[model samples]
Target: MQTWDVIVIGAGPVGENVAERVVASGLSAVIIEAELVGGECSYWACMPSKALLRSGHARRAAAHVRGTGVHEPTGPGAGPDVAEVLARRTSFTSGWDDSGQVEWLQGVGVDLIRGHGRLAGDRVVEVSTANGTDRLQARCAVVVCTGSDAHVPDALAAVSPWTSREATSVEEVPGRLAIVGGGVVGTEMATAYRDLGADVTMLVRGQVLAGQEPFAGELVTASLTERGVDVRAGVTVVSATRDGGPSTPVRLTCDDGQVVEADEVLVATGRRPRTDDLGLSIVGLTDGQWLDVDDTLRVQGAQWLYAVGDVNHRALLTHQGKYQARAAGDVIVARARGTEVLAGQWQRHAATADHRSVPQVVFTDPEVASVGLTAAVAREAGHAVRVVDYDLGAVAGAALHADGYGGRARMVVDTDRQVLLGVTFVGPDVAELLHAATVAVVGEVPIERLWHAVPAYPTISEVWLRLLETFGREG
Candidate 1:
């Protein structure tokens, strides 16, 4: 058995962050990864999905431009090249090599181990690779950033539904796709497949795809419908059975007793922690695991152990995981030096405050970007809040972006603090508008200060001014 200063398992965003910070602290570290060094988000989750979404957005723009009297068509779907779009997205996400990322780790002075790693005991890791089984103990710490697995609904558990793994790396797009769970994954995949020429149908338990914000569900559904996607909302899959050809046809009975069939079924329900086979029990965890962490991203009782990203079940976004990783890395250094790690320092130093101020963008046409709390959440959290919501129709910028540039943007403010508690923007190019709100929220800037920030005239950013005015706070 060989002992190292630190061993980080799962070389994803979080693990990379942890390793990066640890090496910067002059601490020796090793990263063990069984699959791609960049992990799911790089190849599939965020990068690929966003790439796919960008293609769809381009396609929609082309469609709009065709009838425009002023402009000519350009971009991905300039003349309907689905093949080109898929190929472009595939290449962008893969980036041609895992070796490049591994090289980056080497550049930072971190040892890279290509293998599967599990905790054999506290500060001890058992590795399984082509080289063979070896026991490696960490002289300083063991970190887990294993991430999560795409969820397969129990209704189609035995039917072998397609998980995100298959959806991401399919040799060819399905002729017809039926997706379960209208969350971000499902809707983003819908944008992917629908643009790539698949007959797509999304069955959602809720009214729309992750439509937690006001009028959001209706807006997304409208866009998908415009793109020829069938969105059946408030419909639960009562039964799922595979039948017919070698690939099999999926039969779904809806809650309202409507029957539907599709060539392929995709389970985009959610993701579960990738802790199943990992031997975490030695650290007081079950065969299947949960995120064991305190305020500083430290695994509850394990002095030198930490878990981040999807494994923590906090934000689950790649950015959030990286944030958690940064905290865990700092915490490791602090503990080694006998310095105390404060919980309040979470967001200031790292992404530890994901639950408090996390920004998520749903890359759909007329995109969805939200950060911090929602109006309901702010109220529930006992904040005396003022909610200001504005329609894009009311803004000159939205009207100029495109005809019928209908959208909604909302700001939730803690009236007492006169600061934004949350912000939601659902519309075209609204994705870019999120950072402004995120900065306001994170900086705890007062509404008066925000008004002084001022948006450029005749631009979408002007919506910020309109929203603030709606709340009775204006320059």
Candidate 2:
């Protein structure tokens, strides 16, 4: 039996972070991964997807710089260089190789076992590698960072539709592409392929970016339509049929009696946690369900078993998962050392940020960045909330960013606590402005104290001052 202080299943970002934490704390750890060490974010989801979106967004921003004569011509010549963009995207993915990631793990003193890892029992993991099956024991903790797989409905799965992996890594852009969801992946992919010179259509069963503020969806939808994308919302795909050949087209019939034919269909509905084959039954746990964890990211009924990343179902975002992993690792180290630990909210060993201040950024034409709770959610949770809206175009920095800058900023305040409950920014290049909001929300900075933190006159961040002023006036 191979023994280690900790055993991490799935060497994705979350697993890597957890292993790093444990190893840095003077504990030995081993990472078992069936695929590439860098996992989905490095190869397909975040890196490649952002690579595909950045060029188009930058070019659009440059085009918006029309008033500044320093900018170049703004028409057909201003379009993105598709070949160059794809080459850069390939570079971002390291051509889909993970040698660098493996080297980094080795450098950090984390052992790597290439295989499928499953829970055999408490503190015991069974790894199936090419050589044979190996039983491993974790003296401290067995962390499950197995992540998630893109969900494809049975109806669409039978048609062999493309998920996020195919959409982010495709060599050639299809002449016509149909995206099956209006969520972040679907909307971002729609923008990417359309900018890449494909005839793209999005079939959304609900509003685009349904998680964000309503105006966010409206703005993105407008931007997409302006870019010649057919975004059909409130439309469900009843069935999908595709020819057996790779070059053949796919036919999708919607509930609205609409038939859409595309050279390729991309399904971006949701994700399913990778728990079914993890041998959870051996530990008195069910297979194929989202693992529930406490604030410390330890599985509800298991002391030494921890589930981080998307599998835990705390927050399915990569960054949020990393946060959980860090906390969980700290908790494990503390417990192993028999040290007194505080698992309270906002403590070093608790994932309080996951509950109260998770941040998310949607990289579309006009980006959307949000942190903390929305007004509706705050009110739903019975908090006395106040919402303030500000026009991005009114900000001097925004005017300098583009000719006709259009965007909105909103802040949800807790009337009782006098702190920011949430903040949402929607505009070009607004993703950079999100971290400040995240800090404010996470730290629970009081509204009165926020006023003392002055914003430089001409930056887009001045909108913060405006929002505060508006709230002051209303209050």
Candidate 3:
């Protein structure tokens, strides 16, 4: 038996981070990846999707600056050829090959195996390679970091609906597009396709961009609506039809009994954890499709197995997965050192924010980024919630930079702790602004000190100061 200290399955962000950390901690580990070394986030979810949105964002930004000093032509760098943009994105994400990642793994002394590995028995993994079946033994632990897949609603069956993959990788723009769901994927797709010169309609279950701060959807709706996107809120997509030449049509019957249609349909409702074919059955875990993990990311009741990333149904963001991996790796290192001093405190590193502070970002022109609890959620959790908001129009930077200047910001404060319970930012380039709030909330930074961390003058971030002032008065 070729036994190792740790075996990490699914070499995505979470698994890669875990393996890297383990190597640094002086433990031998191997990363087995079935597909591309970087996994779905590189090719599908974050990298490519963000790249697609970047095209739209850049063009819109340039248009906003047309009459200003910092300005560019309204035309996309892709002018009549999105292949250039797609090719650039593909290259950036994959570096045109997986060899770079494999080399990195090797350089870090983490063994890289390109094969499908599944749990076969106790502390054993059966890797099905082209050569043959190679059973690898992990004397210490196995980490599962397989990510999630786009969930396709049953209402639109037997039709080739564009998931994030197709939307991000499309070679040609359709004449019109209909996006189902107003979540991150759907809204970004709506923005991306529309900027690519498609008439887009967004069908959302609740108000458009629902999970964001209360007034956020209003700003996003105004922006998308201005850009010729038919914004239908409080609606659900009933079904889809595909008697098509190039475009796949989807028809939506909303809650208000409104009917809408479009050239192509994108089902961007949400994602389901990838928990198939990797032999979960062998782990004595057969109840839920997803393998639940305790803190330290150990599989529930199975110390030898850990599940991270979307595989554990935790926070799906790439950064959160990396955090999980780091924690799991430390756990393995501590166990190998025979230091059982702190029994299970490190396990809190495993998807702790999966429930509490899972942040989300929708990269629309007036982007929406939120973390922690929404007002309703905080109230549901029984916190005496006080929400303070600011209109972007009031901030100097927002007013000057936004051309028309339409956006909103809201902070949900837990009155008891005087710390931010949740945050929402909706405006141009606000996605980057989320981290500041995320750190503040995650660190439980007292709101008083947070006031001193100054955002640049004449920059949109200065809205933070204005927002804090507003909160002070409201409270």
Candidate 4:
């Protein structure tokens, strides 16, 4: 039996951040990982997917420029360098190696247990290792940062369709690919594979990017359609069949009685919190359900247990998970030291940001970035809200960015408080411009204060200025 001050059950980004924070506070910590130490985002979801998307974005950016360096259309309809894009993705993922991550873990003085870890009881964890089973105990905290797994439809799962893992890490692009879903994962993957020279079709059961501002979805759908992706909205896949293994083509029958054939099919339906086998029932909780946690990120029923990241279901994005992890770790350390933990919103030991300012970016061709509550949500929350819109294309910076630039910007303001409640940006290369909006929303900067923070000349950020002006003009 081995004992540590803290034990983290998953070594994904959120878990790593938790361990780092606890260890930095002078607590001994151990991270138990069954698979790669860096987890899904490092290799499959975030890194590789972004690597795959960047080349196409860069090519389009260059092609739009009138300079000599503009990418001349090559091949049929001027396609991207598929071979180079895949190779770059491989490089970004370090050929799927976790050695660098392991080395960093070691350097941070956080011990690692390479096995499957589950709660044996209160502070006890039983790990199943290749050598044998081992019982480990944590004196301070046992954090479940197990993250989530791709949620695939039972009908499609039977056909062994690709999830985000296979979609991002695929070695070869299929000639024809079908993506079933219109959310972030499905739309992003559709953009990536289609740009990688595959004939892509997307079957969306709901409106594309359903939860975001409608225009965000509309713009993404327009771009995907203009790029030759067959996007079928309001269509659900009733069944899918593939018998000849992974290489075999998958035939999907939709609810609308439409049959689509593809060399490969990817199901990006949703995600399920990974809490089924973590022995949650032993802790007086239901199995296979998202863990409920307080503002301090401590499990509601169990005082010593904490659940962060997707497991808590607060926000599923990687950065938001990391944000939660930081607060959770600090709370654990404060309790261990017998210090009073701050419970105020946005305090050091509270995950207030998860509620009010969770920012997200979808890395499609025309990127989508949003933070805080939309106008509909703000109104639903009982806020007297005013909305503002700006044409990103009309901004001097956007026009200078590319020929025939197009995009839209929106802001939802709390009229009673004179502060921003939400902001959304949809356009080319807008991913980099999200932080400014995030700060505005999170800081709750008043509309009057915002007017003085002048945007530099001819920049897409000028859209911020335009949005504020629009709000004033409307008022």
Show where candidate 1 strays beyond 4 Å.
62-79, 340-342, 345-352, 473-475
lDDT (C-alpha, whole model) for all candidates: 0.80, 0.91, 0.78, 0.91
For every model shown, what is its TM-score relative to the native structure? 0.93, 0.97, 0.90, 0.98
Candidate 2 lDDT score at position 191 = 88
Give me the runs in candidate 2 sitting further than 4 Å from their true place. 67-78
Among the numbered candidates, top TM-score falls to 4
Candidate 4 lDDT at 408 equals 95
Supply the global lDDT for candidate 1: 0.80
Model 3 agreement with the true structure over 240-341: per-residue lDDT tens digits: 556664344656566577876666788888887777777877767662377788767888888689988887777778888887787788878888788762
lDDT of 4 by residue, 1-475 (tens): 7999999999999999999999998999999999999899998899999999988888888898888477644455367778888999999888989999999999999999999999997799999999999999899999999999999888898888899999989988899999999999999999888778889999999999998989999999999998889999999999998868767899999998999999999989999988877999877998789999999999998989999999999999899999999999999999999999998987899999888688999988799999999888888999998889889999999999988899999999998899999999999999888999999999999899999999999888999889988888899
lDDT of 2 by residue, 45-131 (tens): 999999999888876776677654445323443457888989999999999999999999999999999999998877999999999
- Candidate 4 error regions (>4 Å): 69-77, 243-245
Clashing pairs in 3: 295-347, 296-347
Candidate 2: give its CA RMSD in angstroms. 1.6
Each candidate: RMSD: 2.8, 1.6, 3.0, 1.2
Superposed Cα deviation of residue 160, candidate 2 (Å): 1.1
